[model samples]
Every structure is written in C-alpha cells, then in structure tokens.
Target: MHIFVKGAAIAFFSLAITACSSNPDDGFTGKESADVLYSDARTAMETGNFAKAARTLEQLDSRFPFGAYKDQVQLDLIYAYYKQDSTADALANIDKFLKLNPTHPDIDYVIYMRGLVNMQADSYFLHDLLNIDRTDRDPQNAQEAFKDFNRLLKSYPNSKYAPDAQKRMQFLKDRLASYSVKVAEYYIKIDAWSAAAVRGQTIVETFSDTPYVERALEIMVQAYGELGQNTLKQHALEVMKTNFPNNALVSQR
Candidate 1:
C-alpha cells in the first residue's frame, strides 16, 4: 500500500509539473476545475507530495486570482514551496500574504518560517572561504542571510522562533565582525591603510559588543600607523583608551 501511494504521488507530481509548464494558449485545456485543483493540491501537501502541491498551487494562484480560494490557496502554496526548498519563492509569496491578510490568525507562522529559512542559508565560513575567487558567487549572501534572521528577531521578539532567532543572530553578529577584520587585513596588506583603518573603526564603533573588538583595535593601530596621518591615528588610539581601556594591545602600543 505504501509503495502504491508513493507511485501515485510520483505520477500526480509529473502531471502537475506538465500543467505548470504548459502554456495556457496550448490546445489542451485543464481538465481539473479550480475547486478540484485546490482539493487535490491540498491532498498532495497532506500526503507529503510537496512538488505536486506546489505545481497545483501555482496553477490556482495564476488561474484564479479572484477565485474564492485565493487567500487560502496562497497560504498553502507558500508552505508547499517551503517544503520543496524553493525558499525564495516561499518568502516572496509570504510578503504577498502579509499584504493581503496582515491580521490573519497564523501570521506568526510566517515570521517563524522567515527565521527558519535564514537559519538554513549557507554559513559565512563557506561563502567567505570557498567563494574567494568566484566573483560570480556573491560573498554578500551571508550578510543577506543574517539580515533576514535579524529582521525576524526584531519583529517577532516574542514569537515561538524568537529564542532560536536570538541565538542565530548572535552567531551571525560574531561572524560578521570577524569577517570585517579580515577585510581590514586585506586592505592593510594592499597599502590602502586609511581604508583599512575605517573598516577596523567600524568594528569598534558599530560592533562594539562583538568579540572582535580587541582584534579590530589592534588592526586599527597598524592601519593608522601605515597611513602616516598622526591626527587620525591619534583618534584611533583614543578610541581604544575610552572604549577598551583594558585591551592588551592598547598597552602594548
């Protein structure tokens, strides 16, 4: 029975994909009416046939914009996309759902899923280490991922995902600060000392709470010295005295 059910799901998914990819102007009109499509799509989702559910939901959303099931279908479709790891599409539709039904009872689910997708995105280490030479690969994808998690933390501080979001946010904050230090190091090595100084200063000023503060201050000393601007260098030194008085590097200098 289980094997039969799986086989049926595979066949249903194949047909749904064909329906989604086929042009409306094609000769074969859809045999399943919108209501019937909705029923079948939901049945697919309940049975773990995510791809089939997504395809049918896509048809419902496009073909029945003004259909009575528009709102419900949109919500179900987002979940379908999420289950299929089409997270970008799921999130886009989530924004649409919020715009249409801001006061819906399940709004918290949207916020929770937003946090979940951000958490699922690739970590900074993979992007920073592996994509160093791949100019086509965006190094900023990590930043975008963290921003998404932070948004969830900020907006849904009390939601069920809040505790997990907060934990994820801290991890992001630490990694971002460390990555900034590496950028500063790169700039310092390439003789762009002032640029390096500013990047280090940003870590001190903006990410003062992060674990990277001491390292940034140490790098700032070298960056500012190489720039040969005593006045700006003095400012960087003062930041250490005021902000991180006990930072070991401060005394070493």
Candidate 2:
C-alpha cells in the first residue's frame, strides 16, 4: 500500500511539471499549431475583437517564430494594437516591421500606421467636442506625429495615404503654431517682453502659413513696445498691415 501511494504521488508531480512546461498560450488555453492560431487571430481581428486578436497573434508569434506567416502576422499585430488604442504596442510593432522588412510592398501603409498611432497620442478630441482650446497643452506628441506624417510623404509622395497625411500635418502645424502664440501671450501677461517677442518670432518665422501668424504679429508688436523698441514695434505693425490690411489693429497702425 505504501509503495502504491508513493508511485501515485510521483506520477502526479510528473504530470504537473509537464503541464507547466507546455506552451502557455493564455488566450488559446491549449497548444495549437501556428496556422490554426493565425486563423483564429484573423477572425478576431475581422470582427473588431482587437484585444482577442492581439492575444492570439502574440501566441502565434511565440509558438512559431519562423512560421510561414511571420511577417504578415507582425503587420497584422500592428493593426490590432492600433485598434486596441495600444499606441505604444502599435509603434513598437511598426518599428519592428520597418527594420525587418524595409522594402516590403506595403511599407507605405506601415508608415501611415505609424503616423496614425502617434497622432492618437495627442488627439484634438477635446477641441472638437467641447470647443476647448488645446493651446496650453504639450505639443510634443503633436510634433512627433507631424514628423511621422512628413516621413511618409517624403518617402512615398504618391501613396494613397499621402493626401490625408498632408492634411494631418497641416493640422499639427496649426496646433503647434497656436501653442507658440499662447506661450508668447503668457509671457506678455507676465511682462517678459524679450521672451514674448522670441516666442512670437518663432511662430512668424516657422509657421507663417498658419492662421495664428496674425496673432503672433500682434504679440511681437506688444512685446517690442513693452521693451521700448519702437523700431521693432513699427516693423511688426507694417507686417500686420501688409498681411491683414483690413484688420482693425492694422487700420489703427
């Protein structure tokens, strides 16, 4: 009886170890071939179950790193991450795809995806939904997104995504230009005339195409006047007149 009990205990321990050593694909809950896993992941993604898709794709990648569909799986993972609003994951996968398949036929789409992921990191939802200004918010992510879009356009000018990327880039420029104007206004409020003038000058020189250029000129005029620089103030006023002749401020000049 004692010998039988000991043997039973040994067998139970061995089974537990085997289970532990098995592929722990959490979503799958059982070991499955890469093709089956990939098919499951594709179905989940098509149905908009991005969270499930991400989990299954991760399992497929782990179980079969050298699978026939490895490259395509990684690309699909990027899309899944984006749909899940997992921007960090999406960007990481995009980097991997770029490095591994620099000349992939769908490289333009990958570049477009990178821009979309970064764009979501700093969306204009608040401004669009609530009419709230985002001028005081950090524009770092916006700048990153702009660079991403610019890279796509520079590399694939005729890409189907180029038109939308261009529009997004212009929107980012406007947002950044407005942010600069807001900073200059803040400086003006604090009586930091030189700093205010510098901020205003940045907008005028760097983002001349944005609508905030008019407001930037006003900031420059005010800052120069506060700093007792009459010549600079006159120069700003002349610029306003040249660009916005009908503006009341220009009329006053």
Candidate 3:
C-alpha cells in the first residue's frame, strides 16, 4: 500500500513539473523569428497600437540581443516607449543606444527624438499651442529638452531636424524664462522684493530675446518699486522702454 502511495505521489510531481514547463503564462517563450517579431511590432506601431508594440519590441530585444535589426529595434523601442508616455524608459533607452552606437549614422535623428521625448515630458502642450501661460511650475524637463536640442544643433548643423530643434530649443528657453518670471511674480506677491528683483534681472540678462523679458522687466519695475529702490526701478523702466518701446507697461508706469 505504501509503495502504491509513493508511486502516485511521484507521478503527480512529474506531471506538475511538465505542466509548469508548458504553461503559457510562465514567461515569454515566443517561437517566432526576430524578423517576424520586428514586423509585428512595426505593424502595431504604424496602427497606433503603441502598448502592443512596446511589449513586442521588449520581447524581441530579449529574444535577439545581437540580431541584424538590433540597432533599429532599440530606436523603435524608444519611439514605442515615448508613444506610451513612458518617458523614463524612453530617455533611458535612448541613452543606451547612444552609448552603444556613438558613431551611428542616424545619430542626428536619435538626438532629435531625444529632444522630442523630453519636450513631450515637459507637458507644455497647452502653453505651446494655446498660449495659455502656466509658468508657475517646474522646468526640469524643459531644461533637459533645451540641452538635447542644443546638442543636436551643435553636432549636426545641417541636419534635416535642425530647424525644428532650433524652434523647440527657443520654445524651451522661453518657457524657462517665463517660469522665472512667474517665480518673480510669486515672490512679489509674498513681499520678497529682493528675491523677485533678482529673478527678473536674471531673466533680462539670460533670456533677453524671449517675450518673458517684457514681463520680467515689469516684475523688476514692481519689485523695485515695492522695495523703495527708486534708482533701480528707474533703470529697469528705462531698459524696458528701450527694448519694448510703445509698450503699455511702460506707459502705465
């Protein structure tokens, strides 16, 4: 009887192991070739099925680390990650690709994509398209996008993406300067006149080309006036008038 029980237990254990090995939910064990996987991912992406594309690309990467389409796979992974709003993964994968293939012929495109990812991460769509200024926020992503765009322009002056990168870089700079102006305005509201004046002055010095310069100069005017700094106020007003003549702000003062 005991021998019969042991035999039955052994049979159950063996079947369990086999079942576990053959389980579909165990892990990724695709039998498809790398080319097929790549094609599927591409098709999914082209159809706006980004989630599936990201998953399939991830699996393809794992299945064929050194395949013929390895580099393109990495680039596609970045795009998939970006489309999925996975900014951390997108940036990380882009960095990985750059480190692995420093001399890649499409380095310009990679950098452009990097800038695009960061710009998207900035979440400035409303501000960029609608002109709805919301500058009282963090500018970390904008700063990163600015750096990436600037790097691309410097490295690939004649790149097809150069003009767009330059435009985006300018947008980021303007956004950052606008953020400083908002900070200054907040400081003014809290009666931190000195700090407000400093931010305003910094904007005028660093981002003179941005429209925020006008607002920043206005901040300086208000902040210095609050601090009873007549001379500095007059100086800022003169600068504002010189730069933005026919400005309603100067006329109001």
Candidate 4:
C-alpha cells in the first residue's frame, strides 16, 4: 500500500509539471523585455520596415506603458504611422502626445508634423499620378493644415520647423484663395450673382495679399454689375484701377 501511494504521488507531480511547461499562455506571457523590444523596433525603423516597426512599437507600448523610453517610443510610433500613410492613427497619436506632454521640448516638431499629416490627408493618389488639377475639391484638409501651421508659428516662432511651416502656410494661403475663386466662378456660372459677389468680397477681405485678389476684384465687378449695384461695381473697378493699374478689366470698364 505505501509503495503504490508513492508511485501515484510521483505521477501526479510529473503530470502537473508537463501541463505547466506545455501551456501556450506561458510562452506568450514571457514577452521580451522593454529594452530588447525597443531596440528591435528601432532596427526595424532604420531598415525602413515601418510596418514591422509600428507593430513592435505598438506591442512595446501595450506591454510597458511607463517604460523609460515612453516619450521616444510615442514619437517613433508617430513617425512610423506617418511613413505608412496611416494619417488617422498618426494624428491620434500626435494629439495624445501633445495633450499629455504639453511641455515636451519637441512639441514644436510634433505640431509641425501634425500640419504635414493634415496637408496630405486629402491628397488624391491618382490625381498626382495623372497630373490632374484637384484644387477645386473641398479644401477642408488644407484649411486644417493651415490652421495647424499657423498655430505652430504663433506658439513656437523660433523653432527649427518655423521656416518650413511658413513656406507651407504660404502655399496653403494661395491654395485657399484659389479655392475661393473657383467657388465664386461656379456661383457666377449658375447666375447666383449675389452669392458670387459675397464670395468675391470674402476673397478680397480675407485673401487681400494673394494673387487671386485681382481675379476676385474682377469677379466682384461682374457680379455687382449683374446685380445692378452700380455703386459697388464702381467701387470694385476703382480699386482694381488703383491696385492693378493695367488690369484688362479696368480698361474694359
């Protein structure tokens, strides 16, 4: 009886050890350490394997949320998402970083990247491939990008990104002005003279420094004339003569 009991106890212990050793969850639970995972993620990024880098970084984030490299990992993840054209994810991460680390030394860079992501968010791949003019499409993304760049400049004027942000803002301003002009032209085509005049006036008031202002003035004159607002028409013509001296519209008037 004592020998049989001893054999049964040994068999039970062996079975327990086997079950523990063969558990899939145990293998999965033994994740790589934070340092090793971060190193691997960096290597993936350096190799331009952004997809792999993103996955690894996401895993590292989930496993070690408060690790020593937390801030840097978030920044790297943002870059990885941007490189992969995951605009929504990149923006979400950027917003989270900005909200959480408002005083981070690299906040200006984050803001600049936010602007860049928004700038490309609405870009049509096929349009670029075919050299198409899609400026007439909705400028919502461009407007958001413009606001972001403007915010960055206002908040961090001396940042390294300021110069590039300024250049992009100029581009956005011209694009916005052009979009307004297109809207004015469409209103005129539909014989909505009052609406066209309103759009033209908005362009003149808001985008006065843009090249589109000359066209906007022309639109104002045409729309006001069609609406029989002689005073407004003459006002637009006089402004055109003063600013655009040799404008074809002025000579026609």
Candidate 5:
C-alpha cells in the first residue's frame, strides 16, 4: 500500500511540473520572436491597452535588447508609461534613451516629449477640478519643463516640435514669472524689503516679456520705498510708466 501511495505522489508531482512549465500565465518563455512581440505590443497600444502594451514591450526589450525594434520599443514604452501616469518610469526611460542615442534621428521628438512629461508632473488634479490657482506652490517641475523645451528649441531650431515647444515655453515663462511675483509679494507682506526688491528685480530682468513684469515693478517700487531708497524707487516707477503707462501703480506714484 505504501509503495502504491509513493508512485501516485510521484506521478502527480511530475504532472504538476509539466502543467506549470506550460502555464499560459508564465510570461514569455522565449517562444515568440521579437517581431511577434512587437506586433502584439503595437496592437495593445492601438487598442488603448497601455498596461498590456507596456508589459509586452518590456518583455520584448529584455528578450531582444539589441533587436531592430529596440529604438521603437523604447519610444513606445516611454509613451506607454506616460499614459499610465508612471512619470518616474517615463523619465528614467527617456534619460536612458537620450544617454544611449544622443544622435538618434528622433532625438528631437524625445526631448519634446520629455518637456511635456515634466510640464504635467506637478499637476494637482484637485486644483484643476476646483479651478484653484497653484501659482504659489513650488514651480520646480515647471522650471525643469521650461529648460527642457528651451533646450529642444535651441538644439533643433527647425525641428517639427519647435513650434509646439515654443508655445509651451511661453506658458512656462508666464507661470514662472507669476511664481516669482508671488514670492515677491510674500516678502513684501513679511516686511523683507531687500529680499522683495531682489525678487522683483529678478522678475523684471528674467521675465521682462511677461505681464507679471508690471506687478514686479510695483513690488520693487514699494520695497525700495520702504527701504528709503528713493533713487531705486524712482527708477522702478519710471520703468513702470515707460512700459505700462496706464497702470494704477504708476498713476499713484
């Protein structure tokens, strides 16, 4: 009876091993070729199944690191991660691709996408839903995005992405200018006249093209006035009048 039980157990264990080996859930047993995997990934992406697409692409990458589809796979994976809201993963892959393929034909598009990703990295869904202003928050991500877009434009002036990147740079400029203005306002509120004046000066010089320059000049005027720097205050007032003659602050001065 004992011998029969052992034989039955051996038979069941062998069958279980065979079943596990052939399990469909075991992803990528090296059976599918790179082309087949690429096709599967493309179909998933086209169908808006980015999760599946990412998984399949990752498998393909591991299976065929130097395959003909390597570049396209990396690009698609970046987009998939972006769609999945996996910002860190997307950025990591972007950096990796850039490091390895600096002179690749599609480098311009990759840089443009990097800027887009950074632009939305710090977005607050609740703030958008409630129509709340986020200018007072830290603008680090916006700054990075601005630099990325700027690099793209400077490095590839005739790139197809330049026009869109220029537009995004404009938006980021306005946002960064607003953030500086907010900081100047905070310094003014706390009676930090020198700091406020410096911040306002930075805004005037760095963001002279933005609408916030007017507010920055006003802040500088007030801060210098509080510091008893009459000459500096007059200079700020003069610039404000020259640029924004109809501004109420200019009128008051």
Candidate 6:
C-alpha cells in the first residue's frame, strides 16, 4: 500500500508539471514546446490558416513572455492578426511594437505597416462617427493611408520605398479630390454658394494637377453666377479658360 501511494503521488506530480507547460501547438509541452508551437504557427500561416496562426502566436506570447524569440513572436502576431482581418488588433500590436522599439532599424517598416492597417480599417461597412450607414461610401482610409506613406516619402524620400509611396500618394489625392467634389456639390444643393466656392477654389489650388480641378472650376463659375456676382463670375470663367483653354465650360460661353 505504501509503494502504491508513492507511485500515485509521482504520477500526479508529473501530470501537474505537464499541465503547467501547456503546448501552444499540440502535445509538445516544455521550454522546447515554444519552438514546436512557433513552427506550427508558421506552417499554419503558410497554409493560409491565418486565424489559427494568430491564436498560436498569442499563445506563444503568453507562454514565453521573455523568450529569445519573443520579439519575433510579437511581429508574427501582428502579421497574423492583419492576415486574419483583425484590423484593430493588428494596429494595436503595431503601435505597441513602435512604442517599444522606436529606434529599431525596422521602425520605418512598422510605420509603413501602420498605414496599411489603417487603410484596411477604413472599411465601407464599418460604422461612421456620425452613426450613419456608410455601406455605400468608401472609407476615409485612403486619407490616413496617404499620411502614412507620406511619412516614408517625406522623411525617407530616398528610401527604396519612396517611388511606391509616391504612386500611393497619387491614388490618395484622387480620392481626396473626389471627396471635395462631393462636399462642394452638397453645398450647391443647399444654396450655400459661398461654401461651394471655397471648396471649389481649394480643389483648384490644392489639387491643381488633378482632373478634378477642371470640375472644380466649373463649380466655381456656377457658384459665382448663382450669387449674382458677374465680376467674380467673369473672373472665374476667364481663369478657367486661361488654365484650361479647351474647357467645356468655355465652349458653353
């Protein structure tokens, strides 16, 4: 009876130790279990099991909070969250990485990723600040995405990523120009001629390189005419003609 009790006690202790070393993967549990779990997570990610990969990475982070692979684990967790379409989690983890490693050589990569995450988060299906249905509209993600790309464009203009950033900026500019047009048209419908004029002129001045400027000038001409300001109207018309000689508005004149 004494030998049997000792054996039972030893078995209980072994099981307890194993439970404390819970495997993030399958049955492999120990300090070495971390390696196995990470390997499995990498395999999961490669197989496009992004959600499972994220969970595994989370487990690694929780289990080995101070391992040599902790930083890599954190990075993988961020990517896994991003791949799994968890924008909030991805952005939060990216922010945590930036705060903790501000001077890391890969800081720029993190900022670039932040921009990408925000771009994804600015979803058409997401609730807006105004509590209105935004399902039909493009999210403001493009604006934030531009800001992030511009950080790399401006601060590291000579960076290898600069050219791609410039292309992205142009895409952002087009969307922003479209947004201004929508706002200006809204003002026009409300008989807010002054506001429309301001918005139109801003597009003309700020986004002169875009085709939207042509449309903006047309709106400006209409706003001035509606307000019964012939001089301003004539000036706008002339400017439109001067800038865009073949402007359709000029042909109508």
Best by TM-score: 5
- Lowest-sum lDDT 10-residue window in model 5: 19-28
lDDT of 2 by residue, 6-84 (tens): 6676676687567535554455656788878988999988898777788898888888889898888899999998876
1-253 in candidate 3: lDDT tens per residue? 7567666766766875674345243134589899888888899899987777878888899989999988998999998988867899999999988998999999999999999998889885434444455676788888989999999999999999999999988888888998888788789889999999999999999998888888888888888998899999999999989989887878887
Steric clash pairs (candidate 1): none
Candidate 4 accuracy as TM-score: 0.86
lDDT of each: 0.72, 0.86, 0.86, 0.89, 0.89, 0.79
Residues forming the 10-long window of minimal summed lDDT in candidate 2: 124-133
lDDT of candidate 1 over 1-253, digit per residue (tens): 7567666766776886785565442122577688888888889899998777777877777888889998888778877877766668877887788788878876766766655554444433333433343222333644665776677667766777678767776776776787788888888779888888898889888778898987888788887777777777777778778878887756776
Q: Against the true structure, what is every candidate's RMSD?
A: 8.6, 13.7, 14.0, 17.2, 13.6, 14.7
Cα error, residue 19 of model 6, in Å, equals 29
Q: Per TM-score, what order, best first?
A: 5, 4, 2, 3, 6, 1
Point out the higher-scoring one by lDDT: 3 or 6.
3
lDDT of predicted model 3 = 0.86
Q: Give each model a TM-score.
A: 0.65, 0.84, 0.81, 0.86, 0.87, 0.77
Q: Which residue pairs of candidate 3 clash?
A: none
User: For residues 175-242, could you state the per-residue lDDT of candidate 6 as single tens digits?
Assistant: 67878898899899999999999999999888887779889989999999999988988988999889
In model 4, which regions exceed 4 Å deviation? 1-30
After superposing candidate 6, which stretches have Cα over 4 Å from the reference? 1-32, 123-139, 229-231
How big is the positional error of residue 240 in model 6, measured in Å on the Cα after superposition?
Answer: 1.7
- lDDT sort, best first: 5, 4, 2, 3, 6, 1
